[model samples]
Target chain A: MRLLSFILGRAAVALLTILVIVTAAFFLTRLAPGGPFDAEVDLDPLVRANLERTYGLDQPIGIQYRRYLGALAAGDLGPSTTYPDRGVSELIADGLPVSLRIGLAALAIATAAGMAAGIFAARNRNRPVDALVMGVASLGVALPAFVVAPFLTLLFGIYLSWLPVAGWGDGSLRHWVLPVVSLALPQVAAIARLTRGAMLETLSADFVRTARAKGLPERRVISAHVLPAAVLPVVSYLGPAIAGVLTGSVIVEQIFALPGLGRFFVQGAINRDYGLVLGIVILYASALILLNLLVDLAYGWLDPRTRTGR
Target chain B: MLLEVSGLRVAYPARGGEVAVVRGVDLAVAPGECLGIVGESGSGKSQTMLAILGLAGPGARVSGSAIFAGEELVGMPQSRLQGLRGDRIGLVFQDSITGLTPHMRIGDQLAEVLVVHRGASPGAARAEALQMLEVLQIPEPAYRLGQYPHELSGGMRQRVMIAMALLCRPALLIADEPTTALDTTVQAAILRSFAKLKAHAGTALVLISHDLGVVAGLADRVAVMYAGRIVESAPAEQLFATPRHPYTKGLLASMPRLDGPPGGPLPAIEGQPPDPAAVADTGCAFAPRCGIARPACMADLPQPAAVGPAHRVACHAVEPA
Candidate 1:
């Protein structure tokens, strides 16, 4: 029963958050100076006015907001201004799955590699091995995806011909490799540093000392007692970490010429396709809220003190 | 003897040189005996026990020998040391609140010792865990099996920690200030449970604390530590009746007596215990703080002199009486 209420409360908050995001995106996009039809040609002023009227842009801001909310209530994301025949929801449906697949894959690679590096550094702390891990992680963090992406392409795609330089792969493992690596490298570095610090702190906790006192092997003591506490901070960080990965995929998809949400979001904002932009914002906000909720529930499960609110 | 430790020294590397925290201390615990090590904070009492079990933290360098059940433990490989841990040597720590993993359920934590050390099956381990809780006099042992450490009160959590340590029926148990974090009444109750468990299992116990009253109640013999060395040792009653070392005398004198002045201020030992790094190898470390420090005490380190059949004192002013 308590779990039920907790989840219901989170769901309610998630809905409210999505609503606020949608409202803000709607107003901001509309307030931008030029309409989607402006850059196409210097058409007659009367023709442009008629086009505005046809798209409901000539109506009062409040009236347009009400109509948009009504459409949203009926599960309609409305039609795109640039691609007049394509609905906003239709565009999203086409792009979302592809974006999600790549995002999930990158997140998996980041978490696995990051945790391994962190644990290795912590186990061999203050040694040459620890210094080596931190030094590499620092370099990874300093190089942004744009710089790393092209460098990787040049090295593997052009120099050695090891992996494909550009374009998303078609249902093959080789296709996703470069994009995923470029997207995941920075996250992996950040997470590794976070885990290393947390692991060191957890190692010094009294419970860890108690475990060692039991004469348990160092391996068991670290894996069973120390890791659980250390992993908690990483779990909390995963919420924002995941959000960064999703947003980062936009740039990655554009650079690689992929047909994911990243490409659509950029095109929508440039073309001033307000409905499409708002639709993507709503989706991203919802994903963030849900991911954070899941993290909170998992955190409570791992540390019982959080469950009781003590 | 269940355990014998001789010439045990634990040092940690610092900026200039390594400082020995436990300096060549010798101790012995007979089977089924409760030996209490009494000292102020930083006196190296706890480090001595940790070094014996190889639980000292990083940078700690331990030397000399620790013999348990006829096996040398001082330089034993960690793998071999693990085999004796939980199965033959149990340890309970000072703070019950942080002594247990907050994430694990009480039953699983207790059962893990048996499963990991004795290779007991899950079903059998659970049964033994429940039984151990009952032996510790915890109410509703079955219900508690599902609860986490945070769900229990301070005293209950301590009892659970003790139960976890005793699950494999270890031959020797080391409890370091086990009741220090509890209230006076809870401390007494926990001590009572310790006494009962000791009688029931006949486990040799090494109880380390700064509380004279706690040692007087449960220990068969007492070893008084001062600045990384044992200054005096005797049967508990004998040490209290006639303390030889001036430091030991000061310790006993500071304990509030029930039959003494009702409204007077309690006596306190002046000055803090010496830092492990500042202790010199050539002279008595306690001489600067000792009330009866003589010219000889300042120049040379005193060696242990037998005062009675079993009583020993390490002080320049103390002569065999």
Candidate 2:
């Protein structure tokens, strides 16, 4: 009953937040000055007005919002004015999986490599090994995806004759490497720094002292007692880190010519495709809320203090 | 002796140079005997104990010999020391709040010591943990096994710590200020269990605390510490009755007396304890704060000299018996 209540409460809040996000996104995109057909030269004014009427852009802002919400209630995302042949829902369906694939890959790389480096630095603290790990993390954080992308592409794609430079592969591991690394490097550095700080604090806690006094080996003590407490901050940071990675992937996707949500969202914003832009915002917002919820649930499992109604 | 520590020292680095917190201290615990180590905070009573087990934090430099069952413990490898810890020599820390992992179930924490050291199957280890909790007289022992550390009260948590240490039936148990934070009633109950365990298991104990009253209830012999050194040591009764060292006298006088005036101001020691880094290398560490300090007291470091049978005091003020 307690768990159910907690879940219900979180779900209600998530719904309210997503509703607000959709409302604000709707108004902002509509208020922007431009039409989807403005980019096309030699278009007749009558044809443009006819296209705007078809996509409901000719209606008042309030009426369009009500219509959009009504359609959303019926599980419809409306049609893209720029991509007249494709509905917003269809565009999302096609684009989401690609973005999710790259985003998840980057997340995995960040978590594994960052956590390992953090743990290593904490264990060998104040040593040469500690300096080396922190140095690499600093470099990773300092270099953005745009700056690192070209260099990585130059080194691997052109110079070394390894890995593809541009365009998405047909799910090939080699093609996925550079983009995933570029997308994840900054986040990996951030996670590593957070983990290292948390790990240092956890290692010095009295419980960790007791764990050592219990005669458990150092490895068992770290894995069993220290890691859980240390990983908590890292888990909390993951929600925002994931959001930044996905949104940041817009530039990454454009540079690599990848068929992901980033590409569509950017193009939609440039063309002033209100439906497409609002639809992508809603998707990203929903993903962020769900990921944070998952992180909270994981926190409850990792720490008993946060367990609902315990 | 079940365990004997000779010239044990613990030092750590400071901004200027290395300073010894525990300077060449010596101690011994006989089989099934409870040896209480009494001192003020920063007197290195805890550090001395930690050094014996090789559990001192990084940058701490330990020397001298801790002979346990005829084996030197001071220079032992961590792998060897780990084998002895929780198996042959158990340790219980002061603060029950952080002694056990907050995220772990009580039974798992108890059983882990057995599983790791004795190679007991999980089933056997768990059964033994339950039995040990019952032995410690933890109410609803079976129910508590499933609960996390935070769910239990402070006294209950301390009992769990003791139970974990005693589960393996170790030859020696080092409890550093085990009952310091507990109320008198809870302290009594914990002491009763400690005495009972020692009687049944023949487990020698090193009970480190600043509370003389708590130590009086459980210790066979009491060692009084002052500024990282043992100032005096004797049978508990004798030490209380005829405390020779001035520091020991001060500690006893500071304790609230039941037979005295009902409402009198409790006495406190004057001057602050010296920081480890500020300790002088030439003379007694407590000489600065000593009430009966003479020119002789400052000339050289006082060594533990015999005062009576099995009684020794490190003070220039105490003449040879």
Candidate 3:
């Protein structure tokens, strides 16, 4: 019963958080010192009233909220007022694939790099190897994405001439390399530190000593006993790490010219496209909620101790 | 001879110079004979055994001779130690359940020692592993093969550990506090398995433990160490009956007895042994801890004086017992 209550509480928190963000996003975009439809020129008075009536913007705030909430209840996101003949739902559908592809590719890169570095650092302990890896990780974390994005674009995209500097190609595997690497750098460093710290603690545990005395090979002991146990903390941190990546990707998107949701959102902000801005904010928050849920599920699978104890 | 060490010295890096933990200790064991090394923590019993197998961690300073079946153990490379471990030199660790692999299937885990050292095929390893389980008398060996380490009881895991060790017919077996984690009944059974392993394979045994009762049951000869130096050596019965060294006498007296003395609890050893930093001097290491410490005892290191034909004690105060 307690476990059920705990899970329900988490779900309720997520729901309430999403509701508040969505509501605030709806009103804040309107109040952002600009108008959404100020694209070409000033509208005539009669035409502006017709536009207001068409989109139901002429209604009072409370009535408008009730109408929007009713549509939201039916899982309907209305047409984007900033873009003609484009539904908010359609805009989300179009952008989600790009965001997810980038997120997943970056997540994979981070996991591999972080786990390897962690295991290596742990195996080496306080040796020069550990010192070198941690030093590099520190540099990675300290450098902001704004600096890293430009640096990557200049180095790999210009001097090295390995990847395209400013464009994403035909949704192929190759196009993902630069964007994924840029987005994953800080997460990789963070995870490496997490893995190393957790593994160092586990390696000194009584169980590890017993395993060594049982005469397991150095490789097998590290992989089977230490690695699985160590990776758990990294799993728990996936939520915030992915959020950091998603938020970081927006800046990378601006630099790299990836036609992802981040690029769309940036353009919306510049043009004051209220509908587009609100839609993107909702998408971002929902993605965060979904990613965190997956991470929580993974924790239960990784360690049965938590599940049973709960 | 199955296992032998002559004047073995194991050192660790210290300030300016290396600190020798086991300084020139000599031991030899024949087939089917059990030898025990008794000492407090950090007395170098574990280190001495690790040095013999080349299992000491990095930067460890080791010297002297370790000859096992005419093969030199001292200065042996890491690759040689990898091959010898779980194969030529079987190890049964204390804390039985923890000693076994937690993530692995019990049978597959047992077979890993064979596969790693002997290059046994999976099927062959499994068969031999089950046979070993039978040897250790684990119940339902067939079904238990599919179960993991946590699935089994503590006694069963210890049995599996023994089975893994004995599978290769190792010439020498080392049990570092093998039964310390088990209950009284389980401990007896584990000790019985030790005898069976020794008998079946003609394997020599080196039991490193603090438990005198366990030592008395398992060891043919006992070497008593205090402050990283062996202070006395004797047959098990002789050591128990006539413990000549002052430290050895205190250790025996400290053991809880079924027959009690009225008016007071058992006497305690007054103080811990002296610091290891102060140990490698020209005098006895146990002299400060020895109740019968004389001026001569503190002035010069006492050589091993023969008490019985096979027994020796390193103290000037001790006469033939």
Q: What would the per-residue lDDT of candidate 3 be over residues B95-196, giving only the tens digit for each residue?
A: 644565455577777777777777889899999989888878899998889877677788888777778778888878898888888889999998998887
lDDT of 1 at A152: 88
Residue-by-residue lDDT tens digits, candidate 2, B1-321: 999999999999877878899988888999999999999899999999998899998888999999999999998999999889888999998865777898889988888899999899989999999998888889999999999998998999999988888878899999999988898899899989888878888899999998999899889999998778888999999999999998898889899988977896988777888888887767887788888998878888888999999999999989979
Docking class of 3: acceptable
True contacts kept of 1: 0.64
Q: Global CA lDDT of candidate 2, please?
A: 0.89
Candidate 3 local lDDT, A212-296, one digit each (tens): 5555677876877777777889999888898998898888888788888888788888777666777788778988997898788
Report the number of the highest-DockQ candidate: 2
**Separate DockQ for every predicted complex:** 0.73, 0.79, 0.37
Query: Can you tell me which runs of candidate 2 are displaced by over 4 Å?
Result: A40-42
Candidate 2 backbone collisions, by pair: none
Candidate 1 per-residue lDDT, tens place, B22-130, comes to 9989989999999999999999999998887778888789998999999999888888888887779988988757888889888888877888888899889999999
Give candidate 3 misplaced runs (Cα > 4 Å): A1-49, A60-63, A123-129, A156-163, A169-177, A198-217, A269-275, A293-310, B96-98, B139-144
Sort all candidates by DockQ, best to worst.
2, 1, 3
Best by lDDT: 2
TM-score of 3: 0.88
Better of 2 and 3 by DockQ: 2
Evaluate candidate 1 and give its CAPRI docking class based on DockQ: medium
TM-score head-to-head 1 vs 3, winner: 1
Deviating ranges (above 4 Å) for candidate 1: A169-171
lDDT of 1 by residue, A132-229 (tens): 99999999889888888888889989899988878766746777888899999998998899899999999988888877766677888888899999
